[model samples]
Target: MVPLLVPLLLAATPPAPATPAPPRLDDAVPDTFSGVERVVAVGDVHGDVDALKEVLRLAGLLDDKGHWSGGKAHLVQTGDIPDRGEKTREAFELLMRLEGEAQAAGGRVHALLGNHEVMNMLGDLRYVSPGELASFADQATGPETSGSPRGFDGHRAAYGPTGRYGQWLRRHPAVVRIDDTLFVHGGVSPEVPAKTLAELNRWVRQDLFPGNPPGGAANPQGPLWFRGYALGEEQGAGLALDEVLKRFGAKRMVMGHTTDRDGKVRTRFGGKAVFIDTGLSTGYGRHLAALELRGGKVTALYREGRVELVTPVPPPLPIAPKQTVPRGQVSP
Candidate 1:
């Protein structure tokens, strides 16, 4: 009876989570950047083009005319830019244009993949708005066709693998490491198989296409859907969170899937993880904010003022050398 009870208890207990090693680096991969002086990250547009614009301006990344003005600084949009609101098309167009402009200006734009993007690719139109569908109508169809939303075919084509937006989005990454910080649409979890950044990106790209069979990498526990850092207790998940960051050689992780109720950028686990999804779309909360990382410090930028989240500790001053008196020189 005692032996049988021990076996049952072992079966009921869950296996310990797997810890991942640091990912291999590839010079050809664009998912990582270092030595960047400044990085501004925003989250979850939900097709609110105006809200997107407001946050860009707030971060000083965009000009009044919507041109890229961040100079050499990098701008990271942690995904969920489509659905809910009506201006997804315009939002994509703006991002596409800014990508080239920022590159020309010696800067970069990293638009990561969110769960919503994969949903759209998988034909999950649950959150897509009617106005969003109408926004894709061909110009030649005129106003009458636009009112009736005759662009379902066009909308489908545009999001198809061969379409403009689809092709562009497929080439974008799911996670990026800039300096010592990691950015992704959702938080990374330790429950899944250990994977390098390149492997993660390749898997996401493969699953986005129509013909490929799903490998379950896009499941709820994957990088694009995990909400542990945002909703889970640090005392329970803090050790696992440290392992996730270590796997990527990152000091911290910044994500934007789960929206905070107060619409402010919040940190967990002594600022090891940050949540930037302020629900910028009017549908969720109309609040606006962006995360700014510069000069070894982290700040949350809002319309009202900036709040410092992490500040660099100054290095200790070198000790002064003591002088030895010569044997003959003595007392004076």
Candidate 2:
């Protein structure tokens, strides 16, 4: 019986896998950039993927197959990708794909946060079209009527804080500086409390997420809604615009949100600001347009042709009076 006794064997438990570190917030929402030689600024897709494609192709950014063809050219989309049209999902998906492709090709794609985007995130669906909602009908988890597509719930979920599209939108900055120009969905307003570009960017990004009590970006004069540069007179808003430019060290600002009456890209404040929103979406007459900046020259790209914008030479900065040292006195 003693010889039959055997020692018990035990198995060792494996260690748990380590949890991955969370991504840095700043890395996702950068405020400034430089040394970009070529840039294409397009405004307000508004769920019109076809019009967006045409503008991108005209800008030499998209190939015939709708893929990113710009080797090193940066593309700045001034938001409003959702609402007002049927193909909102399609438009957002295209931009999302192009963003990665452009980056891999040594270029960049910037999709700024517009008032509409913030509105959707905050449950404001006034401008959201029924067709746009139907695009997400298949993902709806709520009850569906006999003849109606149950997309309201799905759309809300998609734009929720933890949703994929919501996460992507949250990563974008409200304003970004590339080279000497600033690109924003809405023009910068001097009324905002934030002074520097960095502070403004932070302010908007903070107001975009859940449980933030949303301000600034949603304010009438905030970066996402301000029309001072686009609508205010040069005498009143021009001086404020200059101060904003000086504070940010940017020579000019490019923006969307206020569509041009003639559906053309127009510059304001003596070429200190460019408005690129030409109502490219179907709901706005499907105008195809984009702004091209290359080699320090601004060109407007249209479905018909291109036009160069001549900017005036900026006045020199004021120099302080020379401090002279007294005779026989040493200057420190």
Candidate 3:
């Protein structure tokens, strides 16, 4: 995979200005990002542009005009851009647009890869952005002799190879690190070290993210897709501490993926990882939520929604069974 970082572009604000296309509690609009604040890290935004907007607004990232409200701080987006939520394409666009504006503002937008990006990267096609499904269907039908956007066979060849939409998604980053906290759409893979942010990134690249095989075995899954716990049988605290020991460095892991109710990342991993998923879409109708991290403290950032915790989950998932390292075999 290409290791190119974002271009140096955050010198000035993106004066191009985006006029929001009417709010519909549905899809995302260009101007929905208006007036953002300094540094804000969002959870799995599974295509809830409305919820995302609300959180951004609450975080003081958007202005009344609905532009990039974040002043000098950056925006952290944990992945899972496609699947489940309806407006995933818009969600991806939102990330890209935010990154672009961050560039112009001398600020940065950090987007970490979730399993969705990986699914999209390999052209799995099982999960797709609802917005572009029709377009993808059209591509799969081979060529249309009549309204070929360009012309006949020549026009078909002109269209970008490997399907434009899926092709576009491959450009996203698989992981992002903030201070000691490793930001991933999924949880940490057991095979990968949670010691340092750099070590984690290298593990993703070598064992999990791209390259496919770590010394010939299948690539490990990214954090978000890792639905189960990574440590032993203890409940929340055990997982938390394990995550802290592995990921949060000396601090705690502030992440989104597992369902969090009060915007608190609860775990049995020894206070190592704190989940922030907050089930933003909620599927039922309760609203979404986000966690605000600044200065060395943290707080809940919500879009004015409340979570009615009917029942707290008993025990978290069990720690993954140890994979036997084959004798005479080396991992990448």
Candidate 4:
């Protein structure tokens, strides 16, 4: 019996090493291009699908069934398509679907990343609605030890490196140049002016991925958060705004982080900077509007089919300091 005994330990096998995940795709495409005749830019959707659809319809970008109908025109949504509403998934899915449909139709859909998009990707779900969480439940899965499926976690995963939407979002540029105009979710700051559009987008991609400190893309003053051009003090801010425009070589910068009090897209810095947030989300009362650029002209398009020309005002200059004199002494 002892001679016939076998060593059970010898039959054991070591587990196979895991295959490493594939490298993140460089989805960031060219940030600058030309030859697009018409560009329709919308702002800060914030999960209000109805408002988004209405504005797109007014801009002639969407059909009644929520399909792309813009022909060869380009549609750019300047970020913030999540948070503050329950229909976040609906809005995201529509944009995701439109990207392909528009491209097939010889048009393009640019869904730039907003601050909220960055926040959700990085696990900040403070403003995420419960309904939004429930919407993604079927697609969410977690460890058996973890009780219910995490909806926000699922939503986050859907935009993660392996997620479909995440990959699509990654492929987009934070700053897109259509003809002579620059469209971004927020204003570009002075720090990164020297960077080419490609370089800026690369920095953003790195910031968005894990293991790097989020900078140019997610910082408070980065392209996704800067408000100086929209809400800065009138004097020096205008000069800064001009410098930003000069750096990008753009005739004007169109952005959507700061909503105007009247919920109307407004121009500042002598029309060099246009703020178009216009509270398009139900959280902001659904101010449906879009900025249309065509034939070297810019017009504000509202849901009611009214259009207003956007005229740039003169950029403000620094106030010259008055010559001072010693007390009781007059200047020569």
**What tens-digit string does per-residue lDDT give for candidate 1 at 88-140?**
88888999999999999999999888998778767788888888877776632
Q: Give the clash count for each candidate.
A: 0, 0, 57, 6
TM-score of each: 0.82, 0.84, 0.61, 0.82
lDDT of 3 by residue, 1-332 (tens): 23333333443446676753321212221111223343467777666666776766777766666577675777777766556666665666676677777678766777666665555444444554444343333344355556533222331221223334343433334455455444556555555544554445544434222334451112444454665453335665354445544543444455665655554435434334556676665352434555555554455555554332122236888998878889899854
What 10-residue stretch in candidate 2 is worst by lDDT?
Answer: 3-12
Cα RMSD of predicted structure 1: 18.5
State the local distance difference test value for candidate 3.
0.52
The regions of model 1 sitting more than 4 angstroms off are 1-29, 139-149, 315-332
- Model 4 vs. true fold: TM: 0.82
How far does residue 116 in candidate 3 sit from its true spot (Å)?
Answer: 1.8
Better by lDDT, candidate 4 or 1:
1
Model 1, position 287, has a per-residue lDDT of 91
Query: Each prediction's Cα lDDT score?
Result: 0.84, 0.84, 0.52, 0.81
Summing lDDT over every window of 10 consecutive residues in candidate 3, give the lowest-scoring window: 23-32
Candidates, ranked, TM-score: 2, 4, 1, 3
Clashing pairs in 1: none
